[model samples]
Target: MPNFKLVAPYCGVRKYDKRFFVYYLETEENIRREYIFNTDEDVSNFSHALENLTAFMNNVPVCKKEAYHQEFLDLLLREVDHKLNIRTDPSKPSAVALAIEA
Candidate 1:
């Protein structure tokens, strides 16, 4: 395989007993593709490439980034809290954001 660099990666996360993360990115040549981290090594390798994995929230069309990202952060906090005890919040965000960080 040829070497490729993925820039401005877009990520989505889903829970199926185990969380599944899918990353979408455009190559240096502008080729778009999606990748799934299927193993510990895959995640580890991806993390190594990204010193800081940041969220691309409210990224409409999964490319054009829009909206206040902090809202996503706040929602993430609430969801994490909910996970701690399974408590429901009236103002909870959507059940799924499919947040993938690469």
Candidate 2:
């Protein structure tokens, strides 16, 4: 499974269930052209969707090295943190860290 960075801080959110959330990115070219999906789903499709939409957003036919910005970088970091259940608080150790300590 490949990882995908969130496109924006305010990437749209959907309620899959009370306990689940599906964050999506809206296409700027057209309001109706949104790429909506959930994290809990298959990662292969998720990665493909992200790559395709990102290329479109950058107005490039393929991925480029200088296409990303700070905001996008932050979004990618946050997405990984969220997936790994990493807490922002320094006082508390992450579950994985605690497990290693034990």
Predicted model with the maximum TM-score: 2
lDDT of 2 at 64: 46
What is the C-alpha local distance difference test score of candidate 2?
0.34
Off by over 4 Å in 1: 1-9, 22-70, 82-102
Backbone clashes in model 1:
4
TM-score of each: 0.22, 0.24
lDDT of 2 by residue, 4-102 (tens): 234433232222221122232222221211223244443444445445555555563334422443244346445442232211334443332333235
Error of 1 at 19 (Å): 1.7
Candidate 2 at residue 54, lDDT? 55
Give per-candidate clash totals: 4, 0
List, residue by residue over 1-102, the lDDT tens digit for candidate 1.
112223233323222322222223222222222233345554454444332324333234543442233244344335231222122233433222212221
Q: Cα deviation of 85 in candidate 2 (Å)?
A: 18
lDDT of all predictions: 0.31, 0.34
Report the number of the highest-lDDT candidate: 2
**Which window of 10 residues has the lowest lDDT sum in candidate 1?**
93-102
